[model samples]
Target: MKLHQLEALVASADAGSIRGAARSLGLSQAAVTRALRELEANERLPLLIRAPEGITFTEHGKVLLTHARIVLNQLEHAHNDLERLRGRVEGSLTVGVTPWITLTFLAEAVRLFRERMPDIRLELVEGLMAVAQPLLRDGSMDFAVGQLQPGASELEFASEAVLTYESSVMVREGHRKVRARSIRELLDEDWVLNFAPDGKRDLVDYLFTRHGAQIDERRIVRAQSVATLQTMVEQADMCTWSPTILSHVPPFGGRLRSLALREAFEPRQLGIVTRRNSTLSRAAVAFIDCLLQVIRRHARSAKKEDLALFKTLELLI
Candidate 1:
């Protein structure tokens, strides 16, 4: 119905009670109750159930609440967009980024953005695509930068390929399997996984299965952080898979070496992801421009051989 009515529904759903919603909305409890009652009357449906414990949504209420949240969120984005158009530096932006992207072009892009809009608040979340999609869908995050596998879902998202990298099998400097060239050669050694659940099939699992073989699950070790994964690979007889680019970064390069395994995922590249058909805020457009700028600059300054295969991703003028 009305915007205030939608606000009351969303706030009540989030806070779980009219009193709590009133406090959050900075309105009186009577005001919140009235808004909720009016919203129910307008829709001719009961949206909430009040109990001793808390508030619960009915079936129709649940469906309507989802739309209500989006409306309010889009309204806020609209306000922020207009503020930017008026040359006002107000409102915050949230972006999801994966590890390597954060460590690479993000630093430079953020520098450029901060110089242009110093007062805008920024939130950078780190995780894989699985963790980012829900936030992206709900408008919590404006966009994300991460690896984009082929055949990824396209109905709700769009991708612009930014950088492509070769893949590598990494091991410690003097590890016994450093010379191993085939997938079968390294299946027996201990392995470490260094990413959160990405919902899709993982590199190691896919690698083995592609060759009609499998890695013993018992030999697989889970390491959540880069430091842990590197430490294990460096000090112990273990190995891991990574994008070939990581092997060139300073500290990581010194800790491990890429095995000469002839394996790589097709489209071993990174891209910018956003919700399809959504209008991005002005700040988001500016930040993404910087992202593309950084990628272009990198393609120019980087060694010729290193980016030789990335011709498709790096569209320089």
Candidate 2:
């Protein structure tokens, strides 16, 4: 079938109606209908079942739609590759980043990248790995910077470690309880937890279980935004465990204090994750290089007090 035919099918599937696809593709309703009919005729199968509500794909159409998306993505990549071959770093780069990275080096990297290649457009997708992984696999995201779990090695992606940091239990400055000393000591404290439904919750559960502490579900407040979490901690008697890097930054730097805990938690790995067997654009590579440079510089310029804190956490460069 023609590429336009495949495009029509994919667009229709995404839009859930032929008229919607027509509007999106800048084609008339009759043109979209004709294209769909031609595609089905060529394949000798009914691809879509029309209904009053919308359109639904047949079993065969569902399988074809999957491959159609991949094929369309490959075609787009081919165009990008050709542009790169011409030594043009003027294209779009989409990157997924966790909040920690965004708050740290991402802004600086974006600024540097813009100065180097002003023609290239950069799009940043902020979310956890669970939301970003699918986008990466489907060729929607070029690369991602986030926490890489141990199980990530089993996935069909390649990752390179950028930084390692320990998680710290934090509270507002000058709390009544000076320090926890141990996880068990903080069992009765109100906690502000990450809203992301992932290993973070599991990690907290594991720590509480290992320390023989019962987690009071009623005392737990789930929040995803860093600003919201900071507000909760500053205004209430709530505690949270966050990446140590945040403790050195503003808002948390003076307003919040990391509790001295005798028990150690495992250090988390931050890294760049990219799809395996996919070619990265020159722009994406340049952006990552800029990010690494910023990170290295930040590490080098860290104050003695921050260095001491990093050493205490056993963070490896």
Candidate 3:
């Protein structure tokens, strides 16, 4: 279908109605309706059903909307690239950031990025790689920054590790298990850890299996985001497995502490994830540079063993 037609469809779906789409696109509602009708005629299928509540996509419409968004997003990237190449600092950028990044150095990076490219529109999505994968694949996000786990290569994404550090078991300031030194000591404790679809990758399994003990699945809580995990740890009698650097930052530094267990877990590699074949726009590159700058600056003053991971930062970008 034509670009305008696809834009009309995507805009309608995004805005939830033809009127809203017309307003966003600065066109008349009748023109938007005609464009949608023409798009349906070109495809020989009904795309949207208009109702009082708004619009709903048909099966065919749903399928087209996926590709439509990717196409539109790629076109925007191309436009941004050309503008930057011509010495114009203007465009949009969407970067997915995990909780650790969002709570730590992201604010400084954004400030730096804004100073360098004030005209660019910056959008930050706080989520894990699991949440970011589809968005990155569909071109809704340019890249993601977080802890890269094993098997990430199988997802057809490229990653660049900036910091290498171990994950830690965290507890609230006055937690009963605060003095416990090993995984075995945590069996009876109420734990809040991340979820993995497979049993082998699950943190509960890892903690117990390593100690040759049975998992206390009944007392465990599975959380999707580190933010949620930290909240539970701080406000309740729950301990969570988190990045080592998580407890070293502000607010959390006062609210929580790393368990300092005698046992070791897999090293958490913090990095940037992007679609395998995707070319980052100029804005993406500039934003990442600012992030690295912040990391380097922070490393100079970081005192904790975990926070010092930035000193060993390796850039594969």
Taken over the whole model, the C-alpha lDDT of each candidate is: 0.77, 0.78, 0.80
What residue pairs clash in candidate 2, if any at all?
none
Candidates, ranked, lDDT = 3, 2, 1
Better of 2 and 3 by lDDT: 3
Which residue ranges in model 3 land beyond 4 Å of their true spot?
Answer: 44-46, 85-87, 148-156, 194-201, 209-211, 216-218, 224-227, 297-317
- Model 1 TM-score? 0.82
The list of candidate 2 runs beyond 4 A from truth reads: 1-6, 13-16, 30-50, 55-71, 87-89, 149-153, 198-201, 302-317
Error of model 2, residue 236, in angstroms: 3.3
Candidate 2 global TM-score? 0.82
The sequence of per-residue lDDT tens digits that candidate 2 reaches over residues 15-123 is 9999999999999999999999999999999989999899999998987886687677767767876886898655788899987777666788999989987887778
Tens digits of per-residue lDDT, candidate 1, 13-102, equal 889898999999999999999999998998899888999888999998988886787677678879988887888879888888977667
* Alpha-carbon deviation at 211 in model 1, angstroms: 1.5
Two-way lDDT contest, 1 vs 3, winner:
3
> TM-score, each model?
0.82, 0.82, 0.82
Mark the 10 consecutive residues where model 1 has the least summed lDDT.
Answer: 308-317
